[model samples]
Target: MSYYDVDAILTDAEKVPCQFELDVPYLGHLDNSAGLKPGTALSLPLWLAEMLALASAGEDARAPLTLNLPACLSEAVAAALKADPRAVALRDQSAHLYGVGVRMLDLFDERELGAVLRRTWAVRAADVGLHARKADEAVGGQGAEFLRGLEEWERALFRRGHEGVRRAREWMDRVKRS
Candidate 1:
């Protein structure tokens, strides 16, 4: 995927903010340190809110943050997945769900949202008489196809990014070896 695709996915996933009210004074840490006072209203990223909700729930006493999931989430997911299984891009769908889920990992029960997306897509695909494909294969297939279709400069950017990551891994390994 191009940088634009990644950017779009992030932007879309973060568009909905999770709403919550702090019941206790929050000193705040790096990820969520906003110096929120008691009874203060805080609107944060869905992931962050979910995390805070999970954290507060672990405590024995009354929870500190009252977290509310977006009212439209279920509807939105259903509409998108059920509308057009073939028209929808599985990679983008997976990426969007992953971004949302990563932020709100603690909120999930038995099945994560990514798994839900996979299941939803599978159902839709089956309904449309499509063949079953592994989620990894679908995502990788898109990237491979995109790479093959990219222009010279785009291909170069992808290669440079790959090489940078490889070098970074090697450097970390060398440091560890010392």
Candidate 2:
């Protein structure tokens, strides 16, 4: 089994265009869906997966999948990294030593990045004993490093000179806290 499945990304993006389009289906069913749920059929962002899981529990069948999933996911992954002081200390180290596939998006295309991230997720997921390993052996470290780096970048955007991203993060944080 390939460590990661491109079908995961495709399913997530295809069903919920840009996060905002993800609305509960009629009578709690996913209309226009291929019968895929967040955890089972797709590898959605962790936060999103949790959110859906929560919303699915309540009778309120109309929860909006926050449109800022990419940024939010980027932040969550960063938070996980920061939770461990050792990983936090790794901020700004070598690229491969840190968030390998994600931050490297600037160096490649969406398709390429997706492929790499899938394989990376697979490998790291396996390394950590979650799922199977992503087939592609990354040049440097595991795929989780990229997620950590993305989160770190998101954190720095708050503490760094990027006032807009910082403000946006603050507002989003407020909403999440509420």
Candidate 3:
């Protein structure tokens, strides 16, 4: 994720499940308590969680916290995508679902999760391309529902596909006139 990418910034702000592995006396605000106790589960922004989860205390000490897959990339969502990628409303899950998934993949080694994410992206990208090509006609129809569900990555893909189609049509018109 690039430092200047708006989507990346937003993804970093997405909350993920985390559990404190060590007591933190002054960090209770994270869980609305007096202090964070060991084993205290909390929802923390990806940025903070990543740092805490990776910070080493000593040669033999565990990291301060453990990170869990965010709800957007949970098993239920994966199963839904596996069942029907098109039917899922990705934006509802998280506007930066793919971004969070990518970060989680970097920290974890779940090959099945990675494969499911790849398949979902491939299926949805093709659908986005199709919708982009027919954007004008699909604006007020059922396609609108699908279009509204696209996450940031798919939305970018749709814009590029739409622009390519429009440019191709313009070129074709000029050639015909010539």
Candidate 4:
């Protein structure tokens, strides 16, 4: 989530469902209308939505908007991940699925959702490591399908694991040569 991280920037660009809590005439263009109306729902990028949802008019006033979990983190997707993290194509859901989930988790308190996300990451990470260890053998079979479904973080993990295995083999080869 660093400021300069490309993946973090993309994560902030992921859109989430939001509802305006108050009408603001100047921001109408956001919703393709003359003026933004109260109760108006729109899909807004995480950055804009977070700012709007957290900005209050006064000490006792409510924020301008309410943020909802993005479609990628919907209940159905959670259920699918819970059932089988490997089966769900997270990349298809969002290239930054976990990032959006983390931001939403900060906005809302949903213990179950957090647990599901954590479990999903754990399961898929182990699979990615296994595939990395046997990268050559996995390139053409079922492993390719799973690898293709990985999101940004998982892809990095796979690359690191694969590199580690390659380096270890190279060291072993050098030892044998000596």
In model 2, pairs of residues that clash are: 3-133, 3-134, 78-151, 99-145, 99-146, 100-146, 122-134, 123-134
Which of the numbered candidates is closest to the native, going by highest lDDT? 3
Q: What is the C-alpha lDDT profile of model 1 across 1-178, one tens digit per residue?
A: 5667654445344534433355344555523756665555555655455556556554565455666434333556545655644444444433344345434444545244456555554554342222112222343665555444332323344556556656777899999999
Per-residue alpha-carbon lDDT of candidate 2 for residues 89-157, written as tens digits (9 for 90 to 100): 233432222233343343335553355345444434333322112213442465446445432323333
lDDT of each prediction vs. the true structure?
0.48, 0.39, 0.93, 0.92
User: How should the candidates be ordered by TM-score, best one leading?
Assistant: 3, 4, 1, 2
Rank all candidate structures by their lDDT, best first, as comma-separated numbers.
3, 4, 1, 2
Clashes of 1: 2
Where is model 4 poorest over a 10-residue stretch in terms of lDDT? 136-145
lDDT of 1: 0.48
* Model 1 bad stretches (over 4 Å): 1-16, 24-42, 57-59, 70-72, 88-95, 102-106, 109-116, 120-178
Error of 3 at 111 (Å): 0.6
lDDT per residue (tens digit) for residues 48-134 in model 4: 999989999789999989999889999999999999998899999999998888889998999999999999999989989999999
Number of colliding residue pairs in each model:
2, 8, 0, 0
Instruction: Score candidate 3 by TM-score against the native.
Output: 0.96
